[model samples]
Target: MLNVARTVRCIDDAACEEVQLFTEEDGEPERLGEYRSVSGLRIDKAKVRDARVFRLWGYHIPIIVDEEIKAALEANGIVGGKFEEV
Candidate 1:
């Protein structure tokens, strides 16, 4: 099993639309908007420099993996997960 070390947010330039942002209230912090679809997603490399695996902050559906980990998984013939470069 793979474990995520942290979560990172997409950069401002990410191409997405119709995102719904939830305002901070009742002691809860403001959350990033939810995207039905996103393209040109870019993350701050500095934030994930030490992380081999991580999920997108606030949108945990995409599992990001480093090149080394991707290679290892491919070499091992692991299946079920589809990979796309972000």
Candidate 2:
């Protein structure tokens, strides 16, 4: 299961760009990606605007996804653990 924790740290696009995504490798945070996926391919603008920090499994996956992504994930058996605000 993947656990996601939403944060209000990203108040705007520029600020969101400053956020970093990391992987929980060896029980530690490892730099893996950035928050610029919002400008990537096949992404929903509305969803990117509402993006939040998702703790995917054990990695802090800071990326953007829409309801379709969520639905697909759930449909594939991934579930949210709990509601967390930060």
Candidate 3:
């Protein structure tokens, strides 16, 4: 699960489509009830402006974001983890 600073209920696109999520590791995704079939396409911080972090289960994760998400993490203790991208 992503430990995003904001209390995210879900990840929705501009169209409000729920982004399909899957697991590359284990346990985490299942915990948050998120299942997406990802291609391991990781984005750099430079391109993470549109990204939003989510928690599959409970494993705190860092995700892409513009200003809002970034501020959220920094404001929350989760950012103290000093975690980068996966």
TM values, all candidates: 0.63, 0.26, 0.24
Model 2: ten consecutive residues of lowest lDDT = 35-44
What tens digits encode model 3's per-residue C-alpha lDDT throughout 1-86?
44456433333322322344545465575445453433332433343344465442322343445456667768775634444343
Highest TM-score: which candidate? Answer: 1
Total backbone clashes of candidate 2, pairs 3 or more residues apart or in separate chains: 0
Q: What's the lDDT for residue 3 in model 3?
A: 46
lDDT of 1 at 82: 85
In terms of lDDT, model 2 sits at 0.40
All candidates in order of TM-score, best leading = 1, 2, 3
Whichever of 1 and 3 has more TM-score, that candidate is: 1
Model 3 weakest 10-residue run by lDDT: 9-18
Higher-TM-score candidate of 1 and 2: 1
Task: Report how far off residue 34 is in candidate 3 (Å).
Answer: 24
> After best superposition, candidate 3 residue 69: deviation in angstroms?
0.9
